[model samples]
Target chain A: MRDIYAPRIHGIDTSEIRKVFDLAAKIQNPLNLSIGQPDFPVPAAVKEAMIQALTDNKTGYTPTAGLVQLREAISTYLKPKIGFETEPDNVIVSTGVASILFLLFQTLVAKDDAVLLLDPYFLIYPALVKYHEAQQYTIPESFDEADVNSLNDRLKKDGKKLKLIIFASPSNPTGKILSETQLRLLSNLADEHDAVIASDEIYEAFDYEKRHVSMAKLSPHRTLTLNGFSKSHAMTGLRVGYLAAPPAYAGIVQKMVTLQQYTMVCSPHAMQWGAITALKTGIDAELSVMRKRRDLVYGILSKVTKLPYPDGAFYVYPDVPIDSADFVTRAIERRLLLVPGYIFSANRNSIRISYATREDILEEGAGIFCDMVRELG
Target chain B: MRDIYAPRIHGIDTSEIRKVFDLAAKIQNPLNLSIGQPDFPVPAAVKEAMIQALTDNKTGYTPTAGLVQLREAISTYLKPKIGFETEPDNVIVSTGVASILFLLFQTLVAKDDAVLLLDPYFLIYPALVKYHEAQQYTIPESFDEADVNSLNDRLKKDGKKLKLIIFASPSNPTGKILSETQLRLLSNLADEHDAVIASDEIYEAFDYEKRHVSMAKLSPHRTLTLNGFSKSHAMTGLRVGYLAAPPAYAGIVQKMVTLQQYTMVCSPHAMQWGAITALKTGIDAELSVMRKRRDLVYGILSKVTKLPYPDGAFYVYPDVPIDSADFVTRAIERRLLLVPGYIFSANRNSIRISYATREDILEEGAGIFCDMVRELG
Candidate 1:
């Protein structure tokens, strides 16, 4: 019975972040700073569009790629923003950015194939590479020159086996945006190794300091741009996202669609209509409110400990004076929820705090978190 | 450049059923019978429930398994119907039944593992097996005692290599329900070989001739029962489905939930509420209507060719006088759409007609189909 599972799933456990979510659910109105999605409701126009599509009986399967009109809307909305021509043929609507990553990995990464990761990474990255029985090489910390050199040496060693270089911009667990120099270096490394760059830009809308840059804008031929509306439009439950492959790699897009035809069939159809409307609705007010929350959290936490400056997304990772697991446990006892940094990295001295909640709640949680760190230090 | 793809995805093509769908979209108001879902709009109660859930701001992610109340509702409803207890712990909600199949195959089928298939099977089965690089053996037409003997010999030869024995009862193309004796025999075979049974019963609600018997009721320890609301409530686009394993096999359910956490995150959040309503609302009227269409199709097609008796689902696979590819093309030229049998089986002399559409269109299409066969014969 123990042998019932394949080798791919043998040691893969439920994500530790989801465990924190479960723990938060058990507590009675704790100041929760562990959620990964925005704390806002979906826009009215988007909800209405979904309802109307249901009323109009758009309740059957869409084309395996997605609704034609929705694909067109995504393409039209993406071209100018990403600074590249996003043809509708290369845009595939999926259940979420997560599914796109799964499909992309399933299509490209073979057993023992190498996927380079920039640490600290999103937890799902290594999980996917592991599930495909692929080899993962990690460059500890930032994508600076030192890390870039390490990546170059690793790719040179692995040669043709390095199939992908995957990273998130405005990354989860850390919210650090990759600089243009880093992106360019990665593109060059990918070109030399014939590795595709999978750039996850789901947090593109949350860049507070500077405009977000897409890897496709820099390396159009070899990059797969992954973005979705979950964080931006507050539609996590609606589960709609898209991936744009350059026309030069339309073959990959076609293969993914065929895989999607057997797996997801298509993303939720009525919700896709809602996503089309979401593209037209602006979240500037919400963005401004979140920016203030980020500022407030940063103002409080940086006073107490060494913290990475987060210019985008909704999270801030701060070094804890004590073990992060011990600190997280103590915070839970005090009715505060946070994810330890070890879940996202090999390092175990930090915790991730999300500022995506109500400003008052996030402010109160930040004060409690700082007090805990001070008491322990 | 072609070497960029993994060997697993090298030879897979988009489903031919999707090709027919694309062809139907290009034609004008053709009497379309190739579509796989119910033509009726989703039930009003389900639609209204989804609307209410959205309004109530249940728009964030649910637990990876599903919403608690929805899982409980599914458990409560399935117990009496399946003649066994369905615990929430052993159920996992997924994007669709197709997704569940994908997760199940990915979790259990190692490289070169054997999966026994009953033909004419759903097109997605082999595609999933192929993508996993597994071995698939087919039992050509039905599950008669002769086929059972062959299965026994195959299982004996394969020994521990057979990881799964999968089939769709109230099947997709043929709509043939397995007899209880057949289910008992397969369960014994699975028990003897330590293979799990994957019983796809998505069409259970559409059974017209007799009450559908679940394989889980007889072999609770070995069977995984998959059912969904897509056909029952006409909510195909809502993308919610569940797979219930025995409490003895809760480990499999847990592994699938972990897989879902990374791949789908969860099924569309608000739609799970709609699915809760779908369980309580009866669709007897829709079932009866589909039964009449089944009768009408069997009547028309039996006169012209050898047709498999379809007692469930929305399709009938009838042998054609000409090659099925040629027959499907000829039908399309006359503004009718049908799926050639080779898509589902090695046999290439049949076409699948879906009676899920309007009665008038089905009637018209049946007449055109008979005339074409007569002229060709």
Candidate 2:
């Protein structure tokens, strides 16, 4: 029975997030902050558009790359924004940035190819690279200006095998936005090394201090941009995302679309219709609300533990005095849900707290977190 | 830049269906029968259910395996019907049977492992196998009892390497359903060889003459049954499907779910709500409509080319005297669209006609097909 699976199955578990979900599920009124999705309801207008689509019977399969007009809509939005020499043919619609990233990695990485991830990377990047039988190498350090120079030195030594670099801005655990200079450094390295940059800009709408600069905007020829409506509009269940590549890599884009066509066909047709509205209606109010939450978390958690002030997304990664798994377990015992930093980074001295919930929950969760840290001291 | 892609991508192209889609896009009032989706709208109740789900704020991602009650709904429907010793834990909801198949193959098939497909298989099967770097060995002939014996004898010599077999009943191009005896023979061969079975039952409700028998029922210990709401419920655009495996292979199921969690997360949440209604509502009316169209097609085109009287699904594969590509081209010149047989099989002298459209359109398409054949004669 064990032999019934590919060897990869034995190595792959259900994801460490499952551990947190299982723990959170068992607790009564747990002050949970583990998951990275916005807890807000989808925008009313977007929901209305989807309902209208269903009413109009837009349930037939769209072209595999997605509806041409939706692709056009995406390119129109991104061209002036992301600085791509872009068009509809350069974008492929997908169920999420998840599926787009999966296809992108599989399309680019061969066996033994080295894919570079920024340290404290998204939890799933290594999993994807491992499944493709590729090697995963994180950058020498985080992408501060000094760290970027260190990364360039490492690349100078072993750059030829570098196939892809996937780093999210306003990232998952740290919520740190890459500065424009940082983006330029990575873009230059990717261009010099012939590596592709997968700028996972899923959190583009939540930037607090500066406008988000797409890695593709910094280096269009060597970057593939991944973004979606999931976070910006609280449409995670809708499963709408797109990968925008440059025309110079149309053949690779075609291959990714072909893989998606034979796998998922297209994203759910009705959702694609809803996404048209989602992109049009901005999320300024929601962003402001989240900005306050981030501020509140930074304000309170800073009293308890050392942490960098997060500039984007909705999470704060703070250093914990105890082992992260032990810290999470103790938090669970107190009816609090938190993710260990190791889930995002190789470092294990910190924990990630998402501030995507209501102000009251965020306040309570941060209060409990502070009390726990004081107790640890 | 094309050289930047993995070599596996070089061998892949857009699906053969795309050629039909592209050609049909240009034709005005074309009698198109090249692709295999129903022209019917999604059932009203199901559409309303999805709309209501969106209204109810079911736009957040479900658990990776899908909504628990949805998986329970699928298992409850199949338990008495397919005879699987299964539970909700045994299922993973996917965007469609296409994604399910892709994951199943990647989960089960190792590189160079021999996979057995019935000849004239669905076009996507080989593409999926090749993507996994697997070797595809076809059953000696087709899935008649005679062919089963031929396959058994063939496997007797190479049984150790026979990893999996994928066959669709009430199949896409030919619309042929496997007899019980044929299924039993396949079950015996798979058991003797330790090979897994992927039963693609996407067209289960389309069977008109005999009750559909699932391969999982005959080989529950060694089968993965794939089914979905896309076909019978006419929700192709909604993109909902599931794979049900035996408890003995829980690890495989878990692996599949993990792969999905990291890739697509889950199917669209609103569609899952629609799928619950889709499963409960019967497809008797749609079946009868398609049955009548099948009858209309056989009456007209049986005179023009050699074809089995298709008993299920919406398509009939008819042998043509001239080369299929050439025949399809000539038909296209007259604004008629058909898929050449070479797209499905090594055989190149036939074409596939789908009767999934309105009866009037089916009649016109069949009439045009017959007239073209008569002209050839």
Candidate 3:
């Protein structure tokens, strides 16, 4: 009976982050800092566009790639922002950025093909590779001098088998943005190795320090830019995202589209209309609010705890006084929901607190989290 | 450069059906008929529910499996319909039936494993198996008693390796429904051999002859029922569907959910609420109109050529006077958009005409199609 399933699906488990979400649902009015999406409701204009699409009966399948107009909109919007030109054909709407990543991996990864991932990375990255029976190699922490040199060594060793490198800007769990120098070094390494980079910039619009730089802007020929409106527009459930690759990868990208044509089809049609509005209106208001919440959390947490300097997205990862899983369990017992960093990383040492909630709740949660760490110490 | 792609994706191209769609879009308002969706708009109640969900600020992620109430709604509705009760946990909501089928095959089909498919089958099924690097053996034409005998021998030869059988009820292209006796034989055969049946019942509500019979109803343990709102509620763009399996395969199904969690997240949340309403309201009115279109197509095509008597769905597959591809091309020149059967079938002789359009358009297109066949003869 156990053998009735596909070989790869054995030993599978639910994401630990999702488990926290489930446990959080049972608690009443806890200061929840464990959310993975923005706390704001979708913008009125975007919601209105979706509503209008429903009224107009735009509830049928769009072209397999996406609505051409939305693809065109994404192309125009991303070009100036990323400092690169793109045709509409380069953009493909997906159910969400999650899906684009999945399809991209499925399209490009073969068994034993290795993809380089930065450790303390997004949890799903390695999982996607594993599902495809691909080998995953991790670079410790950041693309600092040592890590970059290590990458060059690993690429030389793996040669053509090291097919991809994936990382996120304003990365999940830890909201660390990759510096331009680091991205440029990565681009050079990829060129030397003849590999590709999957730059996940879903959090691109949430940047607070320098303006977000797309890796694709620096190395369009070797980058597949994966992005979405879920975070910026507070439209997580709307499932609107796009993947853009340089035309050099069009043949492979088209194969990805063909796989999706039979599987996921296009992204949600009405929500794609909402995304058209999202790109048009921009996410300034939401970003400003997220910035404030981040400031509030940082102001409190940095006082008592060792943490990474917050730059973008909505989370702040801090080293815990206790084991990561234990810290998360204790927080849950105290009616606080914070995710353990080990859920996202290779080690069980830190916890992630999302500041995406309103200022007051995030402030309160931050204070409690700090107090809890102090008490444990 | 082709070497940059994954081994499986190299030979992939756009679906032949999609090729027809691309060519059709270039033509002016000819008697268009190459649709695969209901011509009617989404039900007003369903559309309004989606509107209200959006307005109510339900624009954040639901659980990866789906909204609880929606899953519960599907479970309750399907219990009576499928003759076996399932818990909400057994129903996994997906972006569309397309995504579900993709994940299902990706999860179950091991490389080199052989799965049985009905020829003239839905185009996506074989493509999915191929993409997974699995073997696909097609059963000749339809599933009759002889076909069942052939299936048993194939299963015996392949033994445990031949693990899956996939077919659609109220099938696409031909709109043929499997009789209960045929279904029972398949179910018994599956039980005997420890194989599984993937019952694609996306067109369940559109069945016009006998009440739609679910393959899951007879063999819940070995049947994975795939159904969705896109076909029945005219909500193709809404991207809501479910894969229901028995508790025995919860482990396998959980893996499918994990893949989607890392990839698709969940189906569009607001559209899922519409699906809840879709189940509650049913699709009686839409089914009645489609029945008229089915009858209209049968009346015109039956006179000119040999064709399957379509009992449900919105298509009538008719044998043509020339090669399927040649006939499809010829029809396009005459300003009609008919899909050739080779796009859905193993051979290249018949073409499929969709009657999911207005009566006048169907009549005009059918006449043109018949005249073209006569001219070719």
Candidate 4:
């Protein structure tokens, strides 16, 4: 057959995270810290709502934008949490935050348009951008401080070429949460650059030190806020997320949703029901448990030299004494799994350790990881 | 803000189907026949399986490709249906055939790559191909006969520039099923021209006259068969579709799925469970009910002078006696709604009426449509 695969898509390598997952899947071990999914079951209220939806026969195609009630619930939920006032018309329920991000990339990034992505960002961003034939410009995060000057300089210089800026607050690999001031500056810069900021707040509920702030709250006109029930309510498998944007962009995004109609008609009806319940009844208790787990894992990991203070998203980015890849490989050999920082656009010397496990598993896994570090040293 | 949205994306027009949908939504008292969703509920077995999955807490991200058991089930099911012996690894459960089609377009159609689309095609095909920066080459269908010679000549003239060919068997909008001889000729032409064929068989189960034949069964190496439960089991809201391809191209498609991880992580676990049950237990009863509705609507539509024969996919594309747009507008004026064929492609003087509604609704809607056609004549 003729080589029909698109040139831009052929270059995406197999996910490095999946490689670790494959290794973990092979082992017969009981505990798994390798997966990005929350270990907790979906909240009972959410599950019950889904069950109720099924019993009600709410199993037909929803409007391509999504169920109005679910969208309204998301809009209402975001008001107090993110300090943004959004209407049902502004919210589009997606399969997950992943799908929203994909739409954001497709909607904002053109064949030659450049998208600015923070290094040590979620690994999927570059791949999605490249899939749209857009150029991905990685701006390394200055860990020295949550500095906005470097980013501003880059945005000011390459602003015209840049179409979108995507970053996860309480980011993957690095649990770096952008402060309110830093976010404001970034939002201002994005507005100045005429670039849309796609703030991924999927980890909003899992922040330990402080409440997460959404860039959308600061600049609603130029921001697409993406979050879901995946991490917050432990409904990753449910595939429910929402995209909130200014009404000006809703028409365009809804058109993209029309295309998505061919892909996913709408978020699963039962899942949308679950999300409605999740938004109506909050995830405070769930957040508390995740916070406690975050603290427990951080307490154990701090003993290791050069471990940055873990902030959020059930992960700690620690500087490994050895190469991060080697440390991860050896940890896997010891039957413990952690994502290498290299997967998140970082150097190979730092590893990401997820803290979403139970206390006992956290203790055992952290001990193994520390011991492995010492042995390698 | 200097329009952060991509110019290329903004340049593409909003879906014409959605415009018709908006008009339908605006009508105060319309006998709606415009939507493509199955009016039936998902099979009892499917719903029960989903309920069981919810109770069982089968709510976590499946393998990026999809659930192993589901893929295995799909493999087993496809062997006899497609005549292609495939392993589980060759199948990827998608959000729907729409997503798979988008993935295939993104993977194969780079900028300037020409994709041949059968005209009177699924409306989304051209938009999606255009979004990927590919040129769409329309091969107007020969309504009365399968004209392989002309098709081969056109394909041969384009040769390497022709990256892909997309056609729906038991076709959408038209509902005409491609005969086995036509399938063989097209597949052979694709192979000879070194082009990929994407056979959308989402409507296969609704075939009335003959058992459906998968293009993959005829041309295993060059064809990608797209199917899902949305139509077959009335699970449009559930969003589960599968792509069956040969092992060689599976890797490329898998990579695209990996990139799509953010948009939809995996099809909903609950829906996947439901789909497994739907596929295992045949949909003969559901098909019978749908056929009855189809027949009722067809019998009514047949009375309209210029309307064509109803074929497959719960839809009847009939040439309207008046301007197709005017016919639909007049119908709407009289509280009846049907999709104008101009939305499917330009200059087609027809309307697509979905016959998936209940007997009473179908009868009422079809009566209104026939009255409008008679008045126009």
List interface RMSDs for the candidates, in order: 1.4, 1.6, 1.6, 2.0
Would you give the TM-score of chain B in model 2? Answer: 0.95
Off by over 4 Å in 1: A157-161, B157-161
Measured against the true structure, the TM-scores of the candidates, in listed sequence, are 0.97, 0.97, 0.96, 0.94
Quality of candidate 4 docking, DockQ: 0.65
Residue A169 of model 2: what lDDT? 89
**CA lDDT for candidate 3:** 0.83
**Candidate 4 colliding pairs:** A6-B107, A98-B262, A98-B263, A99-B262, A99-B263, A262-B98, A263-B99
Looking at model 4, give its docking quality level. medium
- Where model 2 places Cα greater than 4 Å from the true spot, the runs are A152-159, B140-146, B156-160
Query: After superposition on all CA atoms, what RMSD does each candidate show versus the true structure?
Result: 1.8, 1.8, 1.9, 2.5
Deviation of model 2 at B179, angstroms:
0.5
Candidate 1: RMSD to truth: 1.8
Tens-digit lDDT track for model 1 on B225-272? 898888889878789999988877898899989998889889999899
- Where model 4 places Cα greater than 4 Å from the true spot, the runs are A111-114, A132-147, A151-162, A247-252, B140-146, B155-161, B306-308
What range of 10 consecutive residues in model 4 chain B has the weakest lDDT sum?
Answer: B139-148
Model 1 per-residue lDDT at A230:
93
How do the residues A33-99 of candidate 4 rate in per-residue lDDT, one tens digit apiece? 6668787888888899998898888988787778998888778888876577776777888888888
User: On residues A111-197, what C-alpha lDDT tens digit does candidate 2 reach at each position?
Assistant: 878788887888888888887788777763355667756666775686445788888887877888877878887877776667788
lDDT of each: 0.87, 0.84, 0.83, 0.77
